[model samples]
Structure formats: structure tokens, C-alpha cells
Target chain A: MKLTKFAMAAALLTSIAFTSCKPKDSEIKANVEAALKADMKMANTVVDVNDGKVTLSGECTDAECKAKCESTAAGVKGVKTPVINNLTVAAPVITTPPPASTATVLDAATQQKVKDGLKDINGVTVDFTADKAVIKGTVTPANRMKIMQILASAKVQSDVSGLMDKK
Target chain B: MALQDKYAQLLSAAQTHGVENLSVAEQNGVLHVSGTAKSTADYDALWALYGQIDPNMASGDLMMNIDVKAAAGAQLKVTTDSTNLNIRSTPSTEGEVVGKAAHDEVVTLVEKTDDSWWKVRTAQGEEGYAYAQYLSPM
Candidate 1:
């Protein structure tokens, strides 16, 4: 009888250890997110885990990013399936940027300001370094002038030209 | 209020911003919104509104399917001066770099996600956004 009891206790302990090895949903989610963030391509992806199933939602630049995210999630401990849903791929558009114009160099401060100002501008992109600000995308002539003036005030070189297809 | 009702303002904003084929459905306290946003700003505004209502998206009650479209198949030249272009997961530089395109390498443009980023798929099928400045139409 003692031997049988010992055997039963051992079986119970084994089951408990097996169950304990499984991670909780939240833990799995964190693990997946951490793994993804470590990857530059999956950095922006959001991970959601429920009952061992993982769902990745966010803007993925292309199919490759989405696939990698899914694979990463699936490889996580306790993840049953990795689903890629609501991840949109922003395709490229053929745009007729306005004729090339002079490239102006702007200071870092002015470059930052230009980027901030154009944040809400539709289809507008601002890129600048310590010495130059390059604004692309379609913008109104008035808005273009306003941007240039901002750069001018900061004594930074500005290139308010190129990719200036009138919006 | 129902989850969908809670997000009424966000729905209205999405509508006002011209999200195409907009649809809203709620189940078990989760609100789902599916539509096509006209631009990145339009899509962002919806999320911003959600943030105003639910900070850090704590509730996780909303599922957004808003999508943006761009040219299906276009080729762009990488003109990142001389440095290899980083292919990001999102249109923003803050996005994760999933792949890379060598300078001057011709990448198939997937979409102009916004002014700053062009979604491109490389010849090997690796896809991501290259800085718009570094890319020119072929």
C-alpha cells in the first residue's frame, strides 16, 4: 500500500510540474512582444495573446514583416497559433513630384521644427539633419512658403523643393 | 454604454474623415471598426481619438481594420545618397527595420504610406519602407 501511494504522489507531482511549465497568456504576450521588438522589422508590431493563441496587429510595411511576426509569435513558449490580422501593407504609389528645385540646408533646430509643423500635413514628409531640411510630398504653394520661412528664420538651409506635387 | 456606443465619437470621426465602406460591430464588450482611411492622417486621427478615450489602449475593446491603399506595382530607385536604405515595418523611422535595400538598388514600390515613407518590396520579396528622399521613380 505504501508503494502504491508513493507511485500516486509521484504521478501527481509530475502532472503539477507539467502544468506549471505552461506560461500564462500575459506572459506569452510579453515574451512575443519582446522577441518582436528585438527585431527591427517587427518593432512596431503589437502582440495580443489569449488562451495560447497570438494575434499581431499593426501596420506592417510588407508581407515579409507580417510573416516574420507570425513566425516569431508561434515560436514563443505556450503560443498555439499566431494570427496576422489587421496588418496593412502600404503599397507604393506613382507620384509626379514637382520639378526639382534648389536644395536648402537648415540647422538641426529648424529641421526639427519643419518636421513637427508638417506632421499633420497630408502626404507631406519632412527630413532634415543638423544642416539641412528636405521636405517632400505634395503641398500647397502657401504652405510651402510658410515652411521655407520657418527654415529661413532659423538660419538653416532648406530644400522646400522636389516631390512638391501640388496637393 | 455598449462598447460600440462608447466609441461613437471615434466612429463619427472616422466617418467624417471619409473612411470607405465603414462598418462597426460590437460583441462581448469589444468594438470592431473596419474601413479604408483616405490618408495616413485620417487613419491616425481615429486612433488618436481612441487614445483620448482610452489611454494606452487599456481596454483592448476595439479592433480597427482601417486600411490605406497605394499603387499596386511600381518601381522606385534607391537614392539614399550612399548609405543602404532601411526597410521599416511602418512608414515612420520609428518603425522596425525588417529589411534593407542597397543604395541604387531598384525596389518594387508597394505604396507611398505617407510623404516620408515609401512601402517597397525588394527583388527577394523582403518588404519595408525606404526613406522617401532615398527613393525616386525608375
Candidate 2:
């Protein structure tokens, strides 16, 4: 009976030691989730922990975010090898930039400012025909918005309309 | 209030402790700092890095523009220009004179004390301290 009691006590002690050494599974999950959302700005990732192993999944807005989430999750303690499955990386949004050509009533100086502004971005092909600037180019969403915002800042007298979308 | 207060407290602690080795973290707006510092000035430099702060004071927009050395153990070049150049153990002239450098021998800056003396290393990996005035870029 003493031997059985001793064995039971040892088992209990071993379980306690294991529990203390390993952080709570919920804490690990919360940590992984918070780290990704805070650092990577990923709203789609899901975190799960089982016996100290963490698995993260879901689509991220971009490739940089996906990589950041993986690295950050690995850095947090209590995560033994995170299994990040085939995470879908959505292509960044590409906003169409308005062309600089169409000014209804603008002076030479104003036109020059608009033209100079359009020239700042590389890979942007600007074609002017009939006082209408045909701004054609493919740019990342952020850059596209920045270009449009610059044009708006020019305060041109001309009307900028019908920025084409070719593919 | 808590974040701003925390940053102020940490900044004060850093100044009180030292500034030479300042390591801090600015998350959300609360700046969490640890490690050794060189002086009060170094502590101010660390706070200055927080060019902008978040509304809640939990997020910090740190703009770091430090011109760090290109390589580890990189040789910083220093040239002695003054006619009477003095190599002092500390940044001040009153500091104990440990060694002397030539008129144009460039040395690498290994460490910087709060005072004027800079610990510099040469191309030959020789390390020593010199007055800031007599030293110029190679």
C-alpha cells in the first residue's frame, strides 16, 4: 500500500512539474495572436496551441505581413515550432492614378506644376492630347493614392476625369 | 496619462542611471527602457528619438536616424590636427594623459563617454582616448 501511495504521489508531483514548466496553452494562443495582429497588422490569422506546439493560419494582406507573423510567433516563448500552413497572400490593391492632362482653365505655371508633379513617379507614362493628360501606369495601391493626392494638391484649373484602367 | 507618465519616469531613470548605453522600447506610447546609459544627455537623446506619439500614449512613432558604424569592430578614423594634440583618458583636458597620437593618424571610435574623450581604434586595431578637439575625421 505504501509503494502504491508513493507511486501516486510521484505521478501527481510529475504532473504538477509539467504544468508549471509549460505555460498555459491559452496564454500561448493569446500571445501568438496578439503578436501577429499588433506587429503584422494581420486580421485574418488564427492561433491554436496543443501541448506547446502552435499553428497559425489564414490569409494575410501581403507577403511582408505573412513573414512577419511567422517570425514573431516563433519568437514568443512556449511556442515549440509553429506550423504555419500555406497562408494565402493577397496581392496588394492597385489604385488607378489620375492623369495630369485635363485642365479646364489653368495657367502655364499651374500646368507646369502639374506636369512636374506627374514626372516624379517612375514607370508612369503620361501622354498629352487636346489639353487632356492621359495618365497611364500600373502602381501599387499606396503609390497610386500618393500620385493622385499629389495631383489634387496641384490645384489645377483643368478637369481630371476618366483615368483609364487597362488590366 | 499612464503612458506619458511611464515614459517620463523611464527617461528620468535612464538619466539618473547613465546614458552611454541606452536601450529602450517604445510600444503603443509607453517607452520601456532597460540596460546601462552613459549620462543625462544620452537619456535625452533616447527620448528625442520619439519624434511623434500615439493618441493613447501606448504607441510610439520612433524615428531612428543614428549613423551607426558600418561594420562590427569597424575602425573609426580620427586625425590629430592641432599643433599640440593631447590624448586624455577622459573627454576633458584635465583628464589623465594616457597616450599621444600623431598629427594625422586616424583612429576608430570604439566607445564614447559622456565627457569629451572618445575611445578610438586605429587601422592596426590599437585603441586609445584623445581630446575631441585634436581629432578629426580621416
Candidate 3:
């Protein structure tokens, strides 16, 4: 009888030991999720634990993020080795920049457009050089704005240094 | 980027005012800014900011080619300085004067002939090309 009682006690102790050694799958999942939540990059990752095996699934921004997630799940306590990394790396975003403004060439036709624009504004005269229009004469502030607007519309560069502010 | 830094306020304002198709570039010591402002008030405000940044706009370091948004059939006001805006047979001064739009007179835009000229029609049913600078979209 003593021997039988001793065997029963040993059996109960062994069962308790086994229960303490392996955490429940739900407990493993909670622990792994907590570990992943500590990292902002892992926020989007989905953590699933089944029989101590961890499966990570979701979109990672890059390969580095995916690898880090796998390592992170593997390091969690009670997690099985070789965490399943089903995380997909998202495709890189491509943004086409707006077109850059090009330099305006002062050709004869363009210079003529500048001249035609200046015809209505009095007191301003233009001389076309190799690259830019050389503007001279006294102009009221309003007319000065008009002259500049005209030159800009025609895309003609100008040396307005000779222009004087009309009092 | 020095020119860009110098004109950062103006550039930021352009963005804030919702200038469409805004393009900014620096070349040969000059900064070229091109865009279409949403309204005439916004265009004037930008010009005012430009003048404030560069006194008298005499630096010649910036060439801003901003146009106000005006579509065909939009009403335009003749903005001439107390004189009648001459409508011409063609887009240039060489064209014969076809009609006249008085200062502050409202007219309808037929087409944008070019940057410097637009085809406009007055209330009197006369239609021809007029200098775009003298016509402001209402």
C-alpha cells in the first residue's frame, strides 16, 4: 500500500511539472503579441500561435522589417524554433516629380512678341541682345508692373537696370 | 538653392494659395516660377509678396510667369488704365484695330490666343483679339 501511494504521489508531481514546463498556446500567443507590440515597425504584423508554433503574417515595409519580425517572434519564450514568416514586403512607392521649368530662349519671334506686348505701355523701350531684352526709360509703378508682366508672358529675360521709377 | 531660400516665402505662399501646376526652377542665376493662380486676387497677392521680398522687383533674379485662371467663355474685365483696350484683327499690334473695350468694361473671352493676346468679345457683339494684360478675369 505504501509503495502504491508513493507511486500515485510521484505521478501527480510529474503531471504538475509537465504543466509548468509548457505554457498554453493562448499564453504563448499573448506573450509573442506583447513582444511584437513593443516595436512600432511590427505594429502591422499579425501574430498567431498554435501548439507553441508562431506564424507571422502581414505586410512589412521592407525585407529588413520582415527578418526582424521573424527573429523577434523566435526569441519569445515558449515559441517554437523557426517562426513562420509569411509577411510580404510591400512594393516600393514610385513618385514622378513635376516637370522642371526650362530656360526660355530669346529668339527673334519671341523678341517680337515682347515688342508687341510693350507697344501698349508707354515710355518703355526694349533692345534685344543675344540673350535678354535691355529695357530703358521712366515708367510709373503700374506701367513697370505691366512691363515686367509683358516680359514674363513672352518669357523674355530683361535688364531693367536702366529703368527708372517715375515720380 | 540660394535663390530658392531667398524666395522661400513666396514659394510657400504660392503653395498655400493653391496655385495649380506650380513649377519652380533655378537656372543661370535666375529662379523661374510658373503657375496658374486660382483667382485674380491670389495673383495680385503673389505679385505684392514678390515686390515685398525684392524691393521694386529690381533684382532681376526671379522671373515669375504666373497667370490667373481664366477659361474660354469666362467674363473678363478690361483693366486698361483709363483708356479703351483696342481689339485687333490679329494677335499683334500690326493687326488692324477691330473694336474697343473701355476701361473696366466687362467682356467675354472667346479664346486664349497666346500668353500676350486673347480673343475676346464685347457686349456690342464685336469679337477680336485683345491684349491679355489689359483683360482681367472677373
Candidate 4:
């Protein structure tokens, strides 16, 4: 009886160790799959997080989506500079308006005000479509003025997006 | 009386346009202007408003109290070309050289003088005069 009890305790300890030793690869793979499944918009993508280093793989719709994925990874706790590969860019196609959770609309006068406000800053592109407002452009370190001018006056309903999209 | 009347008018106009707590008073023909602005660039417009009020403010009896105390509306980034750009006592080199600044640093262009020297901010938030030549809308 004593030998059986000792054997049972040893087996229980071994089982706990085995459970704790799940492969890091599987954990990262599960996380990536979960993210992709949760959001169908993220296609052709793979995410790898190991010891705080993130490697985002796969081609995305545009530079904005690629950047968005990288930023999302960076926001994760302990995440370092994401090694973003397998990403390419194409002209942005507006299939349907970004989800109500992802988009916001400004009234006529306020939208005009934002447009006029953006003109004062250089190296920024602001396009106002009927269904949505898209702001995407590149700002060199030398021309960061454009960043402030855009963010300063940019007022969306909420986190719909700041004034400037670092495209 | 013309300047006073117009200053009052401009102050009222600023309040109407969402510029709050703005006060304008002229003493002995010198315009003592005081208010908060949204950004450093926004104040360039205040001077324009002042110009419409009295164009003679150029090289004339007009003093402005434009304290660049943390603009509330907008965040402006001011950069300097030369590293450790010397901040002197006066606009001239002969004046006492006070401190230094770094490159790509953002600050506020709080004031402008007749000599075209713009009083900008430092990374440490110290207000210093920078030559207008090395500076522009940023």
C-alpha cells in the first residue's frame, strides 16, 4: 500500500510538469490562429511571438494594414520591434465601409474644417470619400510638422483613428 | 480711442470664435495683449487680427503680452538645424550666450521680434530666441 501511494504521487508530479511544458511554438501558433479566426479581415497572415519578439508574416491589403498589424503586436506586453515580413502593399480598395466599430463620420461643416486644417500642413494626404474619410501618407523625420498639424485638429468620434494614418 | 475700440472688438471677436479668457488692453498707445492660444502657429493669426485692428502696430506703439504658457488647442513641433544652437541674451552674437538645444527637437514659437528672431522652445521647455532663417512652419 505504501509503494502504491508513492507511485501515484510521482505520477501526479510528472503529469503537472508535462502540462506546464507545452511547446512555445504551439502557444504562438494558437494565438495567431485565434487572432485570424476572430477577424476574417486579416488574411494571408501569420503571427509569431517568442520571448517578447514578434514576427508577423503574410501579405496584407496595404501598407496601412501591415503597419496596423505591427503596431498591434508592439502593443502586446513585452513585445519588441516586430520583424514584419510576408507583407506587401496594393491600392486600397473600399469594399464596404469599415465596420461601425472601426469607422466614424464627421458632419459636413466639421469635415470641411478638417480638410481645410490639413491643407496647412505639408507631406500629408487627406481624401474625403462619400462613404468614408481616408487619411494616409508618409512623413519623413524632417517633415514631422505634418504629424502635429494633422493630430492637433483631428477630432473623430472616438478612437475611430487619429488624424494621420502613417501609411 | 480707435485702437482701444478695435482692440476691444478683436477681443470680442476672439471670444466669439472659441478663443476663451482672452483679454486685450492698450496703455498709452501700447497694446498690452494677453491670452491663451491653441498652437504656436495659431498666434500668427492673432497678429493678423491685430493688424486688421490697427496696421500701424508695425514699428509703432504696440506691445503684446503673448505668454506662451502651454497652448491648449494644438501641439506644435519646432526643430532647429544647428545642434546646440546658442541662445543668447539678445538677438545678437555679442549678447550673453545663455544655453544650447538639440536637433530634431520640437518646441513652440512663442514670440517674434522686429528683427525676425523667433522665440522658440527647447526640449527642456525653456523659451529661447532662434534665428528665423533656420526655422519655418513645422
Give fnat of each prediction, in order.
0.00, 0.00, 0.58, 0.00
Model 4, A1-167: lDDT tens digits are 99999999999999889757654545655655555555455655777766546677777777877776666555544445644555666666668765221223566754554454444345566566553445555544333332322222232221113333335
A64-156, model 3: which lDDT tens digit per residue? 999999998899889999999999999999998654345667777788788887777788888988878899999888888888888888877
Q: What tens digits encode model 1's per-residue C-alpha lDDT throughout A25-117?
A: 889888988989988978988777777888788888889887777887888878885364656776866787642112224544335544644
Best by lDDT: 3
Deviation in Å, model 1, residue B41 alpha carbon: 1.2
Candidate ranking under TM-score, highest first, comes to 3, 1, 2, 4
Q: Where does model 1 exceed 4 Å of error? A: A1-167, B73-108, B111-138
Span of 10 residues, lowest total lDDT, candidate 3 chain B: B51-60
Predicted candidate 3 versus true structure: per-residue lDDT over B1-138, tens digit per residue? 999999999999999999999999898899999999999889888988988998767888889999999999999999888888999999888899999999999999999988888999999999999988888898
lDDT by residue (tens digit), candidate 2, B1-138: 565453565456455655434545444432334443343244334443332232111122221211222233444443322333445555444457566555666566667542234576655554566543234332
- The Cα local distance difference test for each model comes to 0.66, 0.51, 0.88, 0.50
Steric collisions counted per model: 18, 23, 0, 2
| Model 2 alpha-carbon miss at residue A94, Å | 8.8
Model 4 residue runs over 4 Å out of place are: A1-167, B17-21, B59-61, B71-76, B79-138
**Docking quality (DockQ) for each candidate:** 0.02, 0.01, 0.45, 0.02
Q: For model 4, what is the alpha-carbon lDDT of residue B22?
A: 61
